[model samples]
Target: MAHVKDLWWKTVKGPDGEPTQVKTARFGKGKRWLAVWHDQYGSEKSKAFKTKDPASKHANAMETDVARGEYIDPKAGDKLFGDFAKSWFNTVTVDPASEIRYESVYRLHVGPRFDKRKVKAIRPSEIQACLKELEEAFSASLAATALLVIRGVLELAEADEAIKKNPVKSKIVRQPKWQGRDVKVWSDAQISDIIGAHPAPLLPLPVIAAGCGMRQAEIFGLALEDLDFRESVIRVNRQIKKLGENYVFALPKNDKTRTVPMPANVAIVLRQHIEESPPRDYTLPWEKTDGESHTVRLLFRWPTDDQHVRARNYSETVWKPAITAAGIIPPPAADSRGRKRYETTRREGMHQLRHWYASVQLDAMVSVVALASYLGHDPKVTLSIYGHMLPSADERSRSAIDNRFEGSGLVPDGT
Candidate 1:
């Protein structure tokens, strides 16, 4: 049939107008079928079917589809990129923030700039130039995010026959890597000096935060019962995070509960402190009953939960003074020179204590897996980031160990 092709119904003028011609041939799977002349202009194509009934049906529809010029070519369906992306966004459901970012990129960055353009119209040089503009006009992270979204949308457009190829895939956009920070790890001397400077309200907190590496909220949320003196473990089951105005103790982040081994000194200090000032179920110092506040009630008295509205609030009021007394650094030189002196304080935030814990664990040569379980971190993350911090003698063997054999004229590889 392919060799004997171009056979169609020819319309000759006058008489009965035209004669309907049909051809027979074996198609795929070796089945014989009748072919009809569908397109006489424009596409000038034809179709085939196993029966005359379906062939006739297709002839009528093809005539209509051709008349309206709606018969799109499957091969060329993916000719445009941006126009296809909008449809892709509507069809896809993703994480709320990611979805918002994808839509924003399409509307504000990609669609308006390239919607009218074809798939092949987006050039590599042009994409790089656009990316550079994005970095300058916004932030590197935002630019990278926009680039990734554009690449995904374009690929989908190609799949949906909206574009011929994914142009944005080849575009260059560097991702930001986590750089090591020059964070102030609590040294032995600094820890000693800081611990000595504060004696009362702020005194016990440093021991919990710096010594055991408890977060300020975790330290503040400690109830007399949460401490296990016999086991020498502090149960960090609850955390005080500000959901809005007032800080409330919530189930720990990632729904985790971890017990931190405590030193005998820390335990003694806590026991003495608890005996002196007891809290109810380790509740905050700001617990309220019918709008009434009490002391010796919450270890850390914060504003009533109903009074505040913010997420992740720390006990800074008590922390600042403790930090000043500890001499880690003074609370930003109190601004007294009007608007010019209103500089923000450089006090280390809450996570410093967490970082301090990880540093100590690494310095002690604790296994990464152990630290991961202890800190409630994903094992893979702990291994990749902290595994190298304090390398064990036998846990990991570097090339330097084999260098001794090499220097002594040994070649395991038979060199």
Candidate 2:
């Protein structure tokens, strides 16, 4: 049950023994009307209003909401968004790398805007405005990640009954849209030049990337035992990834361990590489930097250090130099301090090898499902990315008709 009380006046027995209303001692001090109700938990809750009608309506609405099992404590969302978001983030379980990335995005992008605000005070328009600002200030991918973090926080708030609704999910808020560019695959000549330009000891790095479609990290973590020459399949079991400042051996991206077919040429190159350079044993923490220790006979290592390859160091010192020597990119220019600085984009990275492999597979008429399995991608995702590289429907139809008509005396006749 809910009721409204007049805080400015009270009813009492008069001198005539009849009930009469009179101003209370606290009259003219604070709101005149109070809406008081018991919540679903049977706990008293109240709101003050300057008018009697609004207070009565609020009390009635509270009673109706409680009866309908849709009640939310108005004060519950008074918790700061930063506090609730941090607590919610701690409860989230993801891969160590992803967890670190989420934390960074929260701290850098999400926290600055909403940390000090109360959860209930955030509105859909405010979220939309924030997203627009993020879109302007960061890359589309980062903006999307920021939106994801915000949504996760608010969704948990809603689930915990701390907020009446998740503003991030409101119809007024729109997620950042990312229009992915078509993958531009490198030509066979370019691949050959790049591979040929690599120093003899690192020749197999680009070969494996172009042939097996292994990611750079996966290549860094390649182990001798994971290669099966007899079966001609590379077991992609683990990858070396950075957890903060320390490197750790972790499962491949998406926690999926898959087997990719090894091309004959790739296997031959690998054998030659092993004969010349030989695999080196290295130990690293498993999953987390401080987790259990694990060792593997890695195929690639920094030449001087004879240790696991650091991605940044390898990229700057090895991969970029090879590409530059191959004429894929211009030579490094000297900065004001006479330090060599190369103008390189992600387009010139080893990931281009993956695009080249996917293009080769698609051009060879491999099925999308099979290519997806070989590349450790979802079938739909593979199709979305490499579908443009596949033979067009019109070309396929023409080929089917031409093959059916061949040797059947169905040549085109001049009209």
Candidate 3:
């Protein structure tokens, strides 16, 4: 229950023999009303008000909220966002790769901005301003990632009832669209030139990439047993990712295992490469922090050393040089200020092959669901990325309508 009382200017003795009315400015203005109540824990709490009506209203609401178990302490939200984020991070369970990404975003982008601010004190405008700053300072994709981390932290705070609402949600703070560089595909001649320039052991890499649409990590993690020749499918189950000096085997992105149909040329190239060079055992940790190990007979290995090829080392020594030799990238330019010279390359990554594979499937009019399954992505995601590659619906519609009148004798001769 809550009650209200007035403080008069004249001193009055209480049961404890102390002055009940203390001299204050409120006494001079005749506005010394106080709402009195006990919290859920039976702790006495009071808020001074200027008049009887507002104080009584506030006291009643607080009492009702406390009784109904919906009361949130005003001081609970005073905790610093940086401290709360550390707690939230521990509560989330994620893979090693994702954990690394989260920590990096927090350290580089999120923590420094809101470390000193209380969680509840963060307003919607502040969040929007931070997002705008991030967009200006970094790529849109990176800005989106940083905002995602901040939103996650605020969501946890909201769930804990530390704040009445999360400012990072919905229209309050929107993540900028990732306006990345345009997608580039290689021509048949360009593909041939690149493959010819690469070494013999790595000859099948380009074929598998363009043919099966395997990501670089998945390509490096491919094993001989994962290929089913009879079914003509490549079973993509796992990928190798680098964490510091250790290589760990983890499930593919989204933890999805899929089988992609193998083209005839791709299968033929894989068979020839396997016959010429046998697979060797590549051992790695099953988990980054654990000592447990797993070994697989990797399809591709480094030429000089019998080990699974690392993506970075392979890209620099094999793929980059191949791009240069194939005339895809120009030779390194000489530096004028006595600095080391560097090469200028096209904006083509190994992912371009994946894009080419998507193009091939879409041009053939494959079902969106089937294509997404083949690429180990959601149907909506596949459409967002490759929907433009689908054949024009207007042309098909016109052809369908035109064919209806053909051979029906309803078509007139040229007038």
- Highest lDDT against the true fold, candidate: 2
Residue range 1-415, candidate 2, lDDT tens digits = 7999999999999999999999998899999999999999899999999999999999999899999989988888898899889888889888788888888989998899899999999999998888888887876667888888888888888998988889887888886754325478778988998898787877888999999988989998999999999999999999999987889999998889999999999999999989988887789999987899999998987889787878888889888988887788999999999999999875789999998999998888889999998888888778777777887989899999989987777876444
Kindly report which residue pairs in candidate 3 clash with one another. none
Best-to-worst lDDT order? 2, 3, 1
Better of 2 and 3 by TM-score: 2
TM-score of 3: 0.86
Order of candidates by TM-score, top first?
Answer: 2, 3, 1
lDDT of 1 at 100: 60
Model 3, which residues run further than 4 Å from truth?
3-11, 14-36, 46-57, 132-137, 175-181, 334-347, 409-415
The positional error of residue 298 in candidate 1, measured at the CA in angstroms, is: 4.8
Evaluate model 2: give its TM-score.
0.92
- Candidate 3 per-residue lDDT, tens place, 243-342, comes to 7667888778888889999889999999998999888777788757474787888899888777788887787778877777777777656688765333
Could you tell which candidate, 1 or 2, scores higher by TM-score?
A: 2
Alpha-carbon shift of residue 189 in model 2 (angstroms): 2.2
Q: Over all chains combined, what TM-score does candidate 1 have?
A: 0.50
Please report, in order, the local distance difference test score of every candidate based on alpha carbons. 0.58, 0.88, 0.81
Q: What are the RMSDs of all candidates, in order?
A: 12.0, 2.5, 3.8
